[model samples]
Target: MSSDLFYALTGASLFTLGLYALIKHAHILRKILAINVMGSGVFLLLVALAAGGQQAFDPVPHAMVITGIVVAISATALALALMLRLREASGLAVLPDTSPEELSEQLPEAPSDVASKNNGKNA
Candidate 1:
Protein backbone atom coordinates (compact mmCIF):
# COMPACT_ATOMS: atom_id res chain seq x y z
CA MET A 1 0.00 0.00 0.00
CA SER A 2 3.09 2.25 0.25
CA SER A 3 3.80 4.68 -2.60
CA ASP A 4 7.31 3.38 -3.26
CA LEU A 5 6.19 -0.21 -3.52
CA PHE A 6 3.38 0.77 -5.83
CA TYR A 7 5.74 2.70 -8.06
CA ALA A 8 8.23 -0.16 -8.12
CA LEU A 9 5.58 -2.71 -9.05
CA THR A 10 4.13 -0.41 -11.67
CA GLY A 11 7.57 0.08 -13.15
CA ALA A 12 8.18 -3.65 -13.30
CA SER A 13 4.82 -4.19 -14.93
CA LEU A 14 5.53 -1.52 -17.52
CA PHE A 15 8.90 -3.04 -18.36
CA THR A 16 7.37 -6.49 -18.78
CA LEU A 17 4.56 -5.18 -20.92
CA GLY A 18 6.99 -3.24 -23.07
CA LEU A 19 9.20 -6.27 -23.52
CA TYR A 20 6.25 -8.33 -24.66
CA ALA A 21 5.11 -5.69 -27.12
CA LEU A 22 8.64 -5.25 -28.49
CA ILE A 23 8.81 -8.95 -29.23
CA LYS A 24 5.28 -9.40 -30.50
CA HIS A 25 5.01 -6.38 -32.79
CA ALA A 26 6.67 -6.11 -36.18
CA HIS A 27 5.97 -2.48 -36.99
CA ILE A 28 8.94 -0.16 -36.46
CA LEU A 29 6.85 2.55 -34.79
CA ARG A 30 5.34 0.05 -32.36
CA LYS A 31 8.76 -1.33 -31.53
CA ILE A 32 10.13 2.17 -30.98
CA LEU A 33 7.25 2.99 -28.67
CA ALA A 34 7.83 -0.22 -26.78
CA ILE A 35 11.46 0.66 -26.26
CA ASN A 36 10.46 4.09 -24.98
CA VAL A 37 8.04 2.42 -22.59
CA MET A 38 10.82 0.21 -21.31
CA GLY A 39 13.02 3.26 -20.75
CA SER A 40 10.26 5.00 -18.83
CA GLY A 41 9.83 1.93 -16.62
CA VAL A 42 13.51 1.88 -15.85
CA PHE A 43 13.44 5.57 -15.05
CA LEU A 44 10.49 5.02 -12.71
CA LEU A 45 12.31 2.18 -11.01
CA LEU A 46 15.38 4.37 -10.63
CA VAL A 47 13.31 7.10 -9.02
CA ALA A 48 11.65 4.62 -6.69
CA LEU A 49 15.03 3.32 -5.61
CA ALA A 50 16.31 6.83 -5.03
CA ALA A 51 13.28 7.75 -2.93
CA GLY A 52 14.13 6.81 0.67
CA GLY A 53 10.76 6.88 2.46
CA GLN A 54 10.16 10.66 2.73
CA GLN A 55 13.85 11.60 2.80
CA ALA A 56 14.99 14.43 0.57
CA PHE A 57 15.36 13.28 -3.05
CA ASP A 58 18.78 11.97 -3.99
CA PRO A 59 20.37 14.26 -6.56
CA VAL A 60 22.27 11.39 -8.26
CA PRO A 61 19.19 9.47 -9.32
CA HIS A 62 17.49 12.64 -10.44
CA ALA A 63 20.52 13.56 -12.51
CA MET A 64 20.71 10.08 -13.97
CA VAL A 65 17.03 10.13 -14.86
CA ILE A 66 17.43 13.46 -16.62
CA THR A 67 20.38 12.14 -18.61
CA GLY A 68 18.45 9.00 -19.44
CA ILE A 69 15.51 11.03 -20.66
CA VAL A 70 17.74 13.01 -22.97
CA VAL A 71 19.41 9.87 -24.31
CA ALA A 72 16.05 8.22 -24.81
CA ILE A 73 14.84 11.20 -26.80
CA SER A 74 17.88 11.12 -29.07
CA ALA A 75 17.66 7.37 -29.51
CA THR A 76 13.97 7.58 -30.35
CA ALA A 77 14.70 10.25 -32.91
CA LEU A 78 17.44 8.15 -34.48
CA ALA A 79 15.20 5.10 -34.53
CA LEU A 80 12.44 7.07 -36.20
CA ALA A 81 14.85 8.36 -38.82
CA LEU A 82 16.08 4.84 -39.52
CA MET A 83 12.51 3.63 -39.73
CA LEU A 84 11.73 6.33 -42.27
CA ARG A 85 14.71 5.29 -44.33
CA LEU A 86 13.61 1.68 -44.18
CA ARG A 87 10.11 2.63 -45.20
CA GLU A 88 11.44 4.57 -48.14
CA ALA A 89 13.63 1.70 -49.26
CA SER A 90 11.15 -1.13 -48.75
CA GLY A 91 7.83 0.69 -48.91
CA LEU A 92 6.53 -1.10 -45.83
CA ALA A 93 5.99 -0.20 -42.16
CA VAL A 94 5.84 -3.69 -40.74
CA LEU A 95 8.90 -5.87 -40.68
CA PRO A 96 8.69 -9.29 -42.34
CA ASP A 97 9.26 -12.19 -39.98
CA THR A 98 11.02 -14.31 -42.54
CA SER A 99 14.45 -15.71 -43.22
CA PRO A 100 16.88 -14.06 -45.62
CA GLU A 101 16.10 -16.61 -48.29
CA GLU A 102 12.40 -15.91 -47.98
CA LEU A 103 13.13 -12.19 -48.15
CA SER A 104 15.16 -12.61 -51.29
CA GLU A 105 12.33 -14.62 -52.80
CA GLN A 106 9.86 -11.88 -51.97
CA LEU A 107 11.87 -9.12 -53.62
CA PRO A 108 11.05 -8.03 -57.13
CA GLU A 109 13.33 -9.25 -59.84
CA ALA A 110 15.65 -6.77 -61.49
CA PRO A 111 15.49 -6.01 -65.19
CA SER A 112 18.01 -7.81 -67.42
CA ASP A 113 19.85 -4.56 -68.21
CA VAL A 114 20.09 -3.59 -64.56
CA ALA A 115 21.25 -7.04 -63.57
CA SER A 116 23.91 -7.05 -66.22
CA LYS A 117 25.10 -3.56 -65.23
CA ASN A 118 25.42 -4.71 -61.61
CA ASN A 119 27.49 -7.73 -62.65
CA GLY A 120 30.54 -5.56 -63.52
CA LYS A 121 29.97 -6.00 -67.24
CA ASN A 122 29.56 -3.24 -69.82
CA ALA A 123 25.93 -2.75 -70.68
Candidate 2:
Protein backbone atom coordinates (compact mmCIF):
# COMPACT_ATOMS: atom_id res chain seq x y z
CA MET A 1 0.00 0.00 0.00
CA SER A 2 2.89 2.35 0.84
CA SER A 3 5.39 3.73 -1.70
CA ASP A 4 8.37 2.32 0.15
CA LEU A 5 6.91 -1.18 0.24
CA PHE A 6 6.02 -0.96 -3.44
CA TYR A 7 9.54 0.02 -4.46
CA ALA A 8 11.08 -2.62 -2.22
CA LEU A 9 8.87 -5.36 -3.64
CA THR A 10 9.60 -4.24 -7.17
CA GLY A 11 13.32 -4.31 -6.51
CA ALA A 12 13.12 -7.74 -4.88
CA SER A 13 11.19 -9.08 -7.84
CA LEU A 14 13.73 -7.71 -10.27
CA PHE A 15 16.55 -9.27 -8.27
CA THR A 16 14.80 -12.65 -8.31
CA LEU A 17 14.23 -12.51 -12.04
CA GLY A 18 17.82 -11.53 -12.70
CA LEU A 19 19.14 -14.25 -10.41
CA TYR A 20 17.03 -16.88 -12.13
CA ALA A 21 18.19 -15.72 -15.55
CA LEU A 22 21.81 -15.75 -14.44
CA ILE A 23 21.51 -19.31 -13.18
CA LYS A 24 19.58 -20.68 -16.13
CA HIS A 25 21.61 -19.13 -18.94
CA ALA A 26 24.88 -20.68 -20.07
CA HIS A 27 26.13 -17.98 -22.42
CA ILE A 28 28.74 -15.57 -21.11
CA LEU A 29 26.95 -12.55 -22.57
CA ARG A 30 23.65 -13.56 -20.97
CA LYS A 31 25.37 -14.03 -17.65
CA ILE A 32 26.83 -10.57 -17.87
CA LEU A 33 23.46 -9.07 -18.72
CA ALA A 34 21.81 -10.89 -15.83
CA ILE A 35 24.48 -9.58 -13.48
CA ASN A 36 23.82 -6.04 -14.65
CA VAL A 37 20.11 -6.54 -14.11
CA MET A 38 20.74 -7.80 -10.59
CA GLY A 39 22.91 -4.78 -9.94
CA SER A 40 20.12 -2.48 -11.08
CA GLY A 41 17.71 -4.24 -8.75
CA VAL A 42 20.14 -3.77 -5.84
CA PHE A 43 20.45 -0.11 -6.73
CA LEU A 44 16.69 0.27 -6.69
CA LEU A 45 16.46 -1.39 -3.30
CA LEU A 46 19.23 0.85 -1.95
CA VAL A 47 17.44 3.99 -3.11
CA ALA A 48 14.10 2.78 -1.80
CA LEU A 49 15.49 2.03 1.65
CA ALA A 50 17.26 5.36 1.74
CA ALA A 51 14.02 7.17 0.95
CA GLY A 52 12.01 5.43 3.63
CA GLY A 53 9.57 7.93 5.16
CA GLN A 54 12.18 10.68 5.14
CA GLN A 55 11.57 14.28 4.13
CA ALA A 56 15.23 14.96 3.35
CA PHE A 57 17.09 12.69 0.94
CA ASP A 58 20.12 10.77 2.22
CA PRO A 59 23.29 10.99 0.15
CA VAL A 60 25.15 7.92 1.39
CA PRO A 61 23.10 5.33 -0.49
CA HIS A 62 23.08 7.59 -3.52
CA ALA A 63 26.85 7.71 -3.48
CA MET A 64 27.08 3.95 -3.05
CA VAL A 65 24.75 3.35 -5.97
CA ILE A 66 26.86 5.62 -8.15
CA THR A 67 29.99 3.77 -7.16
CA GLY A 68 28.30 0.45 -7.87
CA ILE A 69 27.31 1.69 -11.32
CA VAL A 70 30.92 2.63 -12.11
CA VAL A 71 32.18 -0.74 -10.93
CA ALA A 72 29.55 -2.55 -12.99
CA ILE A 73 30.60 -0.64 -16.10
CA SER A 74 34.25 -1.49 -15.57
CA ALA A 75 33.44 -5.14 -14.91
CA THR A 76 31.28 -5.32 -18.02
CA ALA A 77 34.06 -3.89 -20.15
CA LEU A 78 36.61 -6.33 -18.78
CA ALA A 79 34.28 -9.30 -19.25
CA LEU A 80 33.51 -8.29 -22.83
CA ALA A 81 37.23 -7.95 -23.61
CA LEU A 82 37.92 -11.38 -22.17
CA MET A 83 35.01 -12.87 -24.11
CA LEU A 84 36.33 -11.39 -27.34
CA ARG A 85 39.82 -12.74 -26.69
CA LEU A 86 38.45 -16.16 -25.87
CA ARG A 87 36.41 -16.21 -29.06
CA GLU A 88 39.42 -15.19 -31.14
CA ALA A 89 41.73 -17.81 -29.62
CA SER A 90 39.30 -20.73 -29.45
CA GLY A 91 36.77 -19.78 -32.12
CA LEU A 92 34.06 -20.33 -29.54
CA ALA A 93 32.26 -18.16 -27.02
CA VAL A 94 31.70 -20.81 -24.38
CA LEU A 95 34.58 -22.61 -22.74
CA PRO A 96 34.51 -26.36 -22.31
CA ASP A 97 37.03 -28.84 -21.03
CA THR A 98 38.73 -30.67 -23.88
CA SER A 99 41.95 -32.66 -24.17
CA PRO A 100 45.00 -31.15 -25.89
CA GLU A 101 44.47 -33.47 -28.85
CA GLU A 102 40.90 -32.29 -29.24
CA LEU A 103 42.02 -28.66 -29.07
CA SER A 104 44.73 -29.23 -31.65
CA GLU A 105 42.21 -30.88 -33.95
CA GLN A 106 40.03 -27.76 -33.76
CA LEU A 107 42.95 -25.52 -34.77
CA PRO A 108 43.91 -24.88 -38.38
CA GLU A 109 46.52 -27.20 -39.87
CA ALA A 110 50.13 -26.07 -39.89
CA PRO A 111 52.08 -25.64 -43.11
CA SER A 112 53.41 -28.92 -44.57
CA ASP A 113 57.02 -27.65 -44.32
CA VAL A 114 56.59 -26.70 -40.66
CA ALA A 115 54.96 -30.04 -39.91
CA SER A 116 57.79 -31.89 -41.60
CA LYS A 117 60.44 -29.85 -39.76
CA ASN A 118 58.84 -30.69 -36.42
CA ASN A 119 58.30 -34.37 -37.30
CA GLY A 120 62.05 -35.22 -36.91
CA LYS A 121 62.38 -33.45 -33.51
CA ASN A 122 61.25 -34.70 -30.08
CA ALA A 123 58.36 -32.81 -28.49
Candidate 3:
Protein backbone atom coordinates (compact mmCIF):
# COMPACT_ATOMS: atom_id res chain seq x y z
CA MET A 1 0.00 0.00 0.00
CA SER A 2 1.05 3.61 -0.44
CA SER A 3 2.55 5.49 2.52
CA ASP A 4 -0.35 7.91 2.59
CA LEU A 5 -2.90 5.12 2.56
CA PHE A 6 -1.13 3.32 5.36
CA TYR A 7 -1.07 6.45 7.51
CA ALA A 8 -4.72 7.12 6.81
CA LEU A 9 -5.67 3.59 7.82
CA THR A 10 -3.67 3.88 11.02
CA GLY A 11 -5.30 7.19 11.83
CA ALA A 12 -8.74 5.74 11.24
CA SER A 13 -7.92 2.80 13.49
CA LEU A 14 -6.75 5.08 16.27
CA PHE A 15 -9.91 7.14 16.01
CA THR A 16 -12.14 4.09 16.21
CA LEU A 17 -10.29 2.63 19.16
CA GLY A 18 -10.32 5.93 20.99
CA LEU A 19 -14.02 6.37 20.38
CA TYR A 20 -14.71 2.89 21.70
CA ALA A 21 -12.70 3.51 24.83
CA LEU A 22 -14.40 6.83 25.40
CA ILE A 23 -17.84 5.23 25.21
CA LYS A 24 -17.02 2.09 27.19
CA HIS A 25 -15.29 3.74 30.15
CA ALA A 26 -17.09 5.63 32.90
CA HIS A 27 -14.16 7.17 34.75
CA ILE A 28 -13.40 10.82 34.07
CA LEU A 29 -9.67 10.24 33.64
CA ARG A 30 -10.20 7.44 31.16
CA LYS A 31 -12.61 9.60 29.20
CA ILE A 32 -10.07 12.40 29.13
CA LEU A 33 -7.38 10.06 27.86
CA ALA A 34 -9.71 8.74 25.21
CA ILE A 35 -10.43 12.27 24.09
CA ASN A 36 -6.72 12.92 23.78
CA VAL A 37 -6.26 9.76 21.75
CA MET A 38 -9.09 10.73 19.41
CA GLY A 39 -7.59 14.19 19.04
CA SER A 40 -4.22 12.66 18.14
CA GLY A 41 -5.91 10.48 15.53
CA VAL A 42 -7.55 13.51 13.97
CA PHE A 43 -4.25 15.35 13.91
CA LEU A 44 -2.54 12.39 12.29
CA LEU A 45 -5.22 12.16 9.62
CA LEU A 46 -4.94 15.85 8.89
CA VAL A 47 -1.16 15.63 8.53
CA ALA A 48 -1.37 12.54 6.36
CA LEU A 49 -3.97 14.07 4.05
CA ALA A 50 -2.04 17.35 3.84
CA ALA A 51 1.13 15.50 2.91
CA GLY A 52 -0.64 13.49 0.21
CA GLY A 53 -1.59 16.64 -1.71
CA GLN A 54 0.64 17.84 -4.56
CA GLN A 55 3.31 20.45 -3.80
CA ALA A 56 5.84 20.76 -1.00
CA PHE A 57 3.72 20.96 2.22
CA ASP A 58 0.78 23.06 3.27
CA PRO A 59 1.29 25.12 6.43
CA VAL A 60 -2.43 25.49 7.16
CA PRO A 61 -2.94 21.99 8.57
CA HIS A 62 0.16 22.37 10.71
CA ALA A 63 -1.16 25.64 12.12
CA MET A 64 -4.56 24.09 12.78
CA VAL A 65 -2.93 21.16 14.58
CA ILE A 66 -1.00 23.57 16.79
CA THR A 67 -4.17 25.46 17.65
CA GLY A 68 -5.98 22.19 18.35
CA ILE A 69 -3.18 21.17 20.68
CA VAL A 70 -3.55 24.36 22.68
CA VAL A 71 -7.31 23.95 22.92
CA ALA A 72 -6.97 20.32 24.00
CA ILE A 73 -4.48 21.23 26.70
CA SER A 74 -6.75 23.91 28.14
CA ALA A 75 -9.79 21.64 27.96
CA THR A 76 -7.91 18.85 29.71
CA ALA A 77 -6.83 21.24 32.46
CA LEU A 78 -10.41 22.35 33.00
CA ALA A 79 -11.72 18.79 33.08
CA LEU A 80 -9.10 17.80 35.66
CA ALA A 81 -9.99 20.79 37.80
CA LEU A 82 -13.68 19.85 37.72
CA MET A 83 -12.81 16.28 38.63
CA LEU A 84 -10.77 17.45 41.58
CA ARG A 85 -13.59 19.60 42.78
CA LEU A 86 -16.09 16.78 42.47
CA ARG A 87 -13.83 14.44 44.41
CA GLU A 88 -13.32 17.00 47.16
CA ALA A 89 -16.99 17.79 47.53
CA SER A 90 -18.41 14.27 47.27
CA GLY A 91 -15.43 12.05 48.13
CA LEU A 92 -16.04 10.15 44.92
CA ALA A 93 -15.02 10.59 41.27
CA VAL A 94 -17.99 9.09 39.44
CA LEU A 95 -21.35 10.77 39.05
CA PRO A 96 -25.14 10.06 39.30
CA ASP A 97 -24.68 8.31 42.70
CA THR A 98 -26.77 5.43 41.23
CA SER A 99 -28.08 4.30 44.64
CA PRO A 100 -28.52 5.65 48.14
CA GLU A 101 -26.64 2.62 49.46
CA GLU A 102 -23.63 3.50 47.36
CA LEU A 103 -23.55 7.05 48.68
CA SER A 104 -23.89 5.77 52.26
CA GLU A 105 -21.06 3.32 51.67
CA GLN A 106 -18.68 6.12 50.66
CA LEU A 107 -19.37 8.42 53.63
CA PRO A 108 -17.18 8.58 56.71
CA GLU A 109 -18.86 7.73 59.98
CA ALA A 110 -18.72 9.80 63.15
CA PRO A 111 -16.10 8.75 65.72
CA SER A 112 -17.33 5.98 68.06
CA ASP A 113 -15.48 7.61 70.98
CA VAL A 114 -17.39 10.85 70.55
CA ALA A 115 -20.67 8.97 70.30
CA SER A 116 -19.93 7.05 73.53
CA LYS A 117 -19.01 10.26 75.35
CA ASN A 118 -22.26 11.90 74.38
CA ASN A 119 -24.23 8.80 75.33
CA GLY A 120 -22.61 8.69 78.82
CA LYS A 121 -23.49 12.36 79.46
CA ASN A 122 -27.13 11.71 78.45
CA ALA A 123 -27.26 8.71 80.81
Candidate 4:
Protein backbone atom coordinates (compact mmCIF):
# COMPACT_ATOMS: atom_id res chain seq x y z
CA MET A 1 0.00 0.00 0.00
CA SER A 2 2.06 2.91 1.35
CA SER A 3 5.85 3.20 1.06
CA ASP A 4 6.19 2.96 4.82
CA LEU A 5 4.06 -0.18 4.94
CA PHE A 6 6.07 -1.73 2.16
CA TYR A 7 9.32 -0.97 3.95
CA ALA A 8 8.03 -2.55 7.12
CA LEU A 9 6.88 -5.64 5.28
CA THR A 10 10.21 -6.02 3.53
CA GLY A 11 12.11 -5.62 6.74
CA ALA A 12 9.99 -8.21 8.48
CA SER A 13 10.41 -10.65 5.64
CA LEU A 14 14.16 -10.20 5.61
CA PHE A 15 14.35 -10.78 9.34
CA THR A 16 12.24 -13.91 9.06
CA LEU A 17 14.30 -15.29 6.23
CA GLY A 18 17.50 -14.62 8.16
CA LEU A 19 16.15 -16.40 11.18
CA TYR A 20 15.21 -19.36 9.04
CA ALA A 21 18.65 -19.47 7.50
CA LEU A 22 20.29 -19.40 10.88
CA ILE A 23 18.17 -22.29 12.04
CA LYS A 24 18.43 -24.41 8.91
CA HIS A 25 22.07 -23.96 7.92
CA ALA A 26 24.78 -26.05 9.60
CA HIS A 27 27.83 -24.15 8.37
CA ILE A 28 29.41 -21.50 10.57
CA LEU A 29 29.92 -19.15 7.63
CA ARG A 30 26.29 -19.47 6.68
CA LYS A 31 25.29 -18.63 10.21
CA ILE A 32 27.41 -15.50 10.08
CA LEU A 33 25.74 -14.48 6.82
CA ALA A 34 22.37 -15.05 8.38
CA ILE A 35 23.29 -12.89 11.35
CA ASN A 36 24.34 -10.10 9.01
CA VAL A 37 21.10 -10.42 7.10
CA MET A 38 19.13 -10.17 10.32
CA GLY A 39 21.12 -7.12 11.34
CA SER A 40 20.37 -5.50 8.01
CA GLY A 41 16.70 -6.21 8.53
CA VAL A 42 16.79 -4.54 11.91
CA PHE A 43 18.57 -1.53 10.46
CA LEU A 44 15.95 -1.27 7.75
CA LEU A 45 13.16 -1.49 10.30
CA LEU A 46 14.76 1.16 12.46
CA VAL A 47 15.23 3.51 9.52
CA ALA A 48 11.68 2.94 8.39
CA LEU A 49 10.28 3.55 11.86
CA ALA A 50 12.31 6.73 12.22
CA ALA A 51 10.98 8.07 8.94
CA GLY A 52 7.38 7.54 9.98
CA GLY A 53 5.36 10.17 11.94
CA GLN A 54 8.00 12.81 11.74
CA GLN A 55 8.63 15.88 9.60
CA ALA A 56 12.36 16.09 10.31
CA PHE A 57 14.67 13.10 10.22
CA ASP A 58 15.64 11.59 13.57
CA PRO A 59 19.36 11.48 14.23
CA VAL A 60 19.02 9.33 17.33
CA PRO A 61 17.92 6.17 15.55
CA HIS A 62 20.44 6.77 12.79
CA ALA A 63 23.25 7.05 15.30
CA MET A 64 22.06 3.95 17.10
CA VAL A 65 21.90 2.04 13.86
CA ILE A 66 25.51 3.00 13.09
CA THR A 67 26.61 1.82 16.50
CA GLY A 68 24.63 -1.38 16.13
CA ILE A 69 26.27 -2.04 12.79
CA VAL A 70 29.72 -1.67 14.32
CA VAL A 71 28.80 -4.02 17.12
CA ALA A 72 27.44 -6.53 14.67
CA ILE A 73 30.69 -6.43 12.70
CA SER A 74 32.68 -7.00 15.84
CA ALA A 75 30.48 -9.89 16.82
CA THR A 76 30.70 -11.41 13.39
CA ALA A 77 34.48 -11.18 13.48
CA LEU A 78 34.61 -12.90 16.82
CA ALA A 79 32.25 -15.59 15.61
CA LEU A 80 34.38 -16.21 12.54
CA ALA A 81 37.52 -16.46 14.60
CA LEU A 82 35.90 -18.93 16.93
CA MET A 83 34.58 -20.94 14.05
CA LEU A 84 38.05 -21.11 12.49
CA ARG A 85 39.53 -22.31 15.71
CA LEU A 86 36.88 -24.96 16.03
CA ARG A 87 37.48 -26.11 12.51
CA GLU A 88 41.21 -26.25 13.07
CA ALA A 89 40.92 -28.19 16.28
CA SER A 90 38.10 -30.54 15.35
CA GLY A 91 38.21 -30.58 11.54
CA LEU A 92 34.54 -29.84 11.57
CA ALA A 93 33.11 -26.43 10.72
CA VAL A 94 29.83 -26.04 12.55
CA LEU A 95 28.42 -28.85 14.66
CA PRO A 96 30.31 -30.48 17.51
CA ASP A 97 31.79 -33.96 17.20
CA THR A 98 29.02 -36.47 17.63
CA SER A 99 30.60 -39.80 16.68
CA PRO A 100 34.11 -40.93 17.47
CA GLU A 101 34.42 -42.73 14.13
CA GLU A 102 33.52 -39.58 12.20
CA LEU A 103 36.08 -37.58 14.15
CA SER A 104 38.81 -40.09 13.35
CA GLU A 105 37.88 -40.07 9.70
CA GLN A 106 38.19 -36.28 9.50
CA LEU A 107 41.74 -36.17 10.81
CA PRO A 108 44.32 -34.73 8.44
CA GLU A 109 46.64 -37.19 6.74
CA ALA A 110 50.24 -37.47 7.79
CA PRO A 111 52.81 -35.47 5.85
CA SER A 112 54.09 -37.06 2.63
CA ASP A 113 57.57 -38.57 2.31
CA VAL A 114 58.77 -35.50 0.39
CA ALA A 115 57.63 -33.20 3.18
CA SER A 116 59.33 -35.40 5.74
CA LYS A 117 62.56 -35.28 3.76
CA ASN A 118 62.34 -31.50 3.59
CA ASN A 119 61.84 -31.31 7.35
CA GLY A 120 64.89 -33.53 7.91
CA LYS A 121 67.04 -31.31 5.64
CA ASN A 122 65.92 -28.17 7.49
CA ALA A 123 66.80 -29.73 10.80
In order of appearance, the predictions have TM-scores of 0.78, 0.74, 0.76, 0.77
All candidates' lDDT scores? 0.81, 0.79, 0.79, 0.80
Between prediction 3 and prediction 4, the one with superior lDDT is 4
- Candidate 3 colliding pairs, count: 0
Query: Can you write out model 3's per-residue Cα lDDT over 1-123, one digit (the tens) per residue?
Result: 669768977888999999998888867788889999999899989988888846698999999999999999999999999999876554556553256355455544632444445557678
List the lowest-lDDT window of 10 residues for candidate 2: 110-119
Best by TM-score: 1
Q: Least lDDT summed over 10 consecutive residues: which range in candidate 4? A: 107-116
Top lDDT hit: 1
Candidate 2 vs candidate 4: the TM-score winner is 4
The Cα RMSD in angstroms, rounded to one decimal, for candidate 4 relative to the true structure is 5.9
How close is each model in CA RMSD to the real structure? Answer: 4.8, 6.0, 6.8, 5.9
Clashing pairs in model 2? none
> Which is the better candidate, 1 or 3, if ranked by lDDT?
1
Residue range with the least summed lDDT across 10 consecutive positions in model 1? 110-119
